[model samples]
Target: MTPVVELSGVHWGPKRQADILHDLTFSVAAGEVLAICGANGAGKSSLLRLLYRHQAPRKGTVRLMGRDLWLMKAPEAARIVAAVLQEQPTDFALTTRQIVALGRLPHRKGFGPGTLDNAVVEAALRRMDLTAFADRPFGTLSGGERQRVMVARALAQEPQVIVLDEPTNHLDIRHQLELLALLRGLGLTVITTLHDLTLAADFADRVLVLHQGRIIADAPPSQALTEATIARAFNVTARVDRSGPAPRFSFQLHG
Candidate 1:
């Protein structure tokens, strides 16, 4: 099967010369959830930005299902890739439903939102369990509620590929698992950045460990979450145990 997203030697950053991602090459197949794991300043956000077309790569190329990302129009690209960024602002005074309905803007023709569009937004809110708070002001919601609303908005886009940056940031334990399970059930090409190693192992089909803007390890969670990799990438010692269906890590603080 053809991969949904592919990056070959892609390098991007603020300046034309300073490259954040150095010769990064990876591909995510359809219906697979790939987690990008790394410590702070590892360029995880930069990679996601490049994939979502927020910033173009200064070198190399990014292709979505064999089509060059740069060659695709903005709306066409937005139609395929939906993103829930880490830094979501709560300053927007719009209601939860209104904020989510904005996702349908790409498909909207005029200023007024249509019934069909509202239906999609409603469905998304239901999926995220935000129906009760749909009419509430988005800025008035709690952090976790706001996070769910953002996810609902992204789902409203109905994109083929979903890029999430710290999606579980403000979610509770139960909601975190539920959201991850929901994403997995969607069978969309998912690329997410997660700080929780255990959650990453449990949810992601594959894990990519980035260090200093380079991919240090790319493999299934069972194989990728080794003691050595964790210690090196995260600067924390850990013991890996596979007693359950998935490998679990117990952190060991270094002296």
Candidate 2:
């Protein structure tokens, strides 16, 4: 079976001088949740940009649903992959519903909003618990609320794959669990970059650790997030305890 997403020998960099991602190869099966974990400047965000086609890899191919991502039209790709990145676009004057309704742009048949489109937006609002705030201006919302709104927009897109860059950013503990749980329940192919190793271990079926532009570890979290791997990737002394669903860690900064 064809992988839902695949990258082979992918190398990417904004300039010709330095590569942010080097020879990165991975495949995500349909309906699997894969979390990418790494410290800062490990090219986590760059890899996501490749997946979403925001930036093309300087070398190698990114395939989606067995087709070349670059070969697909913008609307065609938009229908298959929806993303929630860390930075949001300016929506000062737009309401929550309006911001989410933009997700339907790929599916729009005519100029104005349709009944079905409106319904999808409504459903997304409810799913993200923004129904009461649907009419409120997006700029007025709290950071967590805005993050949820971004997710609602992605949900509204109804894509086969969801890519999130730090999906837990700005969310409180309760909402973090709620959002991660919601992602798991969706049954869609998910690829997210998370700084919290514990959250990655707890929520993801598989974890891939990136370091200095390469994948250092790729396996089930229990195997991938070992004490050795943690120390090497993070440059910190740490212990990994496998007593629960996710491996717990105790850390000491290296001197």
Per lDDT, the best of the predicted structures is 2
Best by TM-score: 2
> Candidate 2: which stretches are off by over 4 Å?
none
What are the per-model C-alpha RMSD values against the true structure? 1.4, 1.0
Tens-digit per-residue lDDT, 1-255, candidate 1 = 778999999877787467777889999999999999999999899889998988888889999989999999988898899999978755578999889987898777878988998889999999999999988988889999999999999999989999999999988999999999999999899999999999999999999999888899999998788899989888888898887776778886797
* Candidate 1 worst ten-residue window by lDDT: 11-20
What TM-scores do the predictions have? 0.96, 0.98
Error of 2 at 192 (Å): 0.4
Count clashes in each candidate, considering only residues at least 3 apart in sequence or on different chains.
0, 0
RMSD of 2: 1.0
Return the number of clashes found in candidate 2: 0
